[model samples]
Target: MVSPVTVVKCEGPKLVPFFKATCVYFVLWLPSSSPSWFSALIKCLPIFCLWVFLLAHGVNFLVSRCGAKRIFAGLIFSALGDAFLIWQEQGYFEYGLLMFAITHILYSSAFGMKPLDLKAGVVMGLISSFLYTLLYAYLSSPFTYLVGVYTALIAFMGWRAIAGVQLCNDLWTWTKLSACIGSLLFIVSDLTLAVNKFCFPVPYSRAIIMATYYAAQMLIALSAVECRDENEYKKKIKVT
Candidate 1:
């Protein structure tokens, strides 16, 4: 088993920059209803930059720790999703959602899950199903079916993130919790996007969506790195 200290070391420094960037970008780019065209584009720039940063970070972690390829692919897809979304009003909304859908699938695969606690998993599934139904009820055609499928994918991704946590000591458990929280934040980000797009616009919804979105991506990226390191450490112990 990987020691708890190693897990902490892997997570500590990486998390600081991720969280710092998330916070700094959110404050600097709070969405304005009356932004000039150039200003709007400038605001959208940070998300792309953050995605690129995380993509590089994930690739480096994989290089050093033998991380799962799916995690790396997820980050790439996320960057593509951000790129597509920056032009969402220019009719790239569907393409953006499609990219994010693929990202969620890759993420779920990397954070592989099993039905460890049947009762808990069942409860989580039921809850997600209910929420999915509620969301689908409000959406209209073209978007209705697409949004329905995306919501279900994200819900399951979140569920699996939680279920994938190993039964280990506290620090190691936190690594899993990071993944779980990240996945849930992703769900929140998309849910807010759906509400802002389909249901009704909340004032300054973009700020909420982007804040959660970047934070989610960063935490998930960090979790992927730490997970890879922990697993490698386990293999080393086994071999020795």
Candidate 2:
């Protein structure tokens, strides 16, 4: 059996602090009367901390275990995306999107989703088509093409994540569930950002976007802890 000390040591140390920082950022950003510079500082500070936290988790995952390398890599890409997007005013939006695109690709690889069943495939295709049509209607020329490509990647990643949830034998486990939820929330957060940027304004959109994004990242990170190697995990199961 795994000892309590081992569990404590292997688990992420930054989860609590990350959430605390997120809460503080939200409080700072959401209030209408809050100073603009304060809000910007709060936003940038937490993301810097978040990237650091993810890097630490990636190191822990890499040194202590195998089969989690893709997850670690994904976290690194996610951190880069977070850092780039934090400075959207400095013409970093495209760079940020590229980082996130890489992030989604890494995450999709980590999921290791199987070929989709027919119904799931059909549904995902229809959803992707509808989203593309809607987005294209709203976007301008270059962005129409650019965002379309990005959306395709996002849709593929989301499909893979959902497929993992359906096909993984550990569907009932916290790890699988967390990844699935995280994937869904990631999509939601990105869509919100896209709509706010490309379509219309949503009040307190930044708060909504950041909250969902942070939650998604946290869940994805937690999944790494909740799940290790399938072989090792199965061995533990058999021993118990």
Candidate 3:
């Protein structure tokens, strides 16, 4: 017979399988149920918990510790914007857009502060402005307008990143590349959301949009981790 301690050790791996089974059952049962307040609350509970985890652990703790103070603040603002967007009652969308616009600006500033290249900025600005105008013409929503502004900011920052490749003396290329990829994913997710909101009524639209959005957010968090790792590597090199 196995000792009690050995039995407990053997059962540990089973816990994950049991938890996954429970979650699967709960999710499957959720949409078929009656329309009650508690039912709605239960349906949204997982997403609410995810939002809290992203804010508290992913953005606040991880990014703050990674030496990206301004970016962390911007992410907090973006999380607030996400909350406002999810509420979906009243005219909170506009406020959410404003908050997110500020977030994009903060992120742009954080990334672009060192480059100081006016020519690149102007070129990116012109291209982004034209794209924004085209998207606005097609979309005609306040959310689209906000996305336009955010796109322009991203373009500016992206240009800075490209230009600064030569100037990255500390050789944190991987971190920078990860950040660039994360930014691109974020743009793709935003564009997908805009399409979903304004253009076509695709099936499983919410699922697709949320999946992309969450993935983009997670990529951004990974960029923060990359930054932290790069910083530590540089510190180690200096000490050696």
Q: Estimate each model's TM-score.
A: 0.73, 0.75, 0.58
> lDDT at 60 for candidate 1?
62
Q: lDDT per model, in order? A: 0.68, 0.69, 0.54
**What tens digits encode model 1's per-residue C-alpha lDDT throughout 137-227?**
6777888788778877887788778776655433335556778889888888887887787777878788788878877876676566554
What is the clash tally of candidate 1?
A: 0
The C-alpha stretches of model 3 lying farther than 4 A from their native spots are 1-67, 116-127, 139-148, 161-172, 202-204, 225-240
The TM-score between candidate 2 and the true structure equals 0.75
Q: Put down candidate 2 lDDT per residue, 1-240, tens digits, no spaces.
A: 333344334444555567678778766554533334455556555555655655655577566654256666776777667666666667777888888888888877877656455665567668878977877778987788878888888777777767766544543455666777888888889988998888889787877787788888777766666544455545544554
Ranking by TM-score: 2, 1, 3
lDDT score of model 3?
A: 0.54
RMSD for each model, in Å, please? Answer: 5.5, 5.5, 10.0
In candidate 1, position 45 carries an lDDT of 51
For model 3, residues 1-240, the per-residue Cα lDDT tens digits are: 223343233323323433343355365654422344454444344334333433443455545553355556566776666666654345566776777677666656656555466775687678767756756756665556567667776676566544444434554454455455655566666666666655666677656654555455443433443323334444544543
Error at 61, model 3, angstroms: 9.7
Where does model 1 exceed 4 Å of error?
A: 1-24, 27-67, 166-172, 227-240
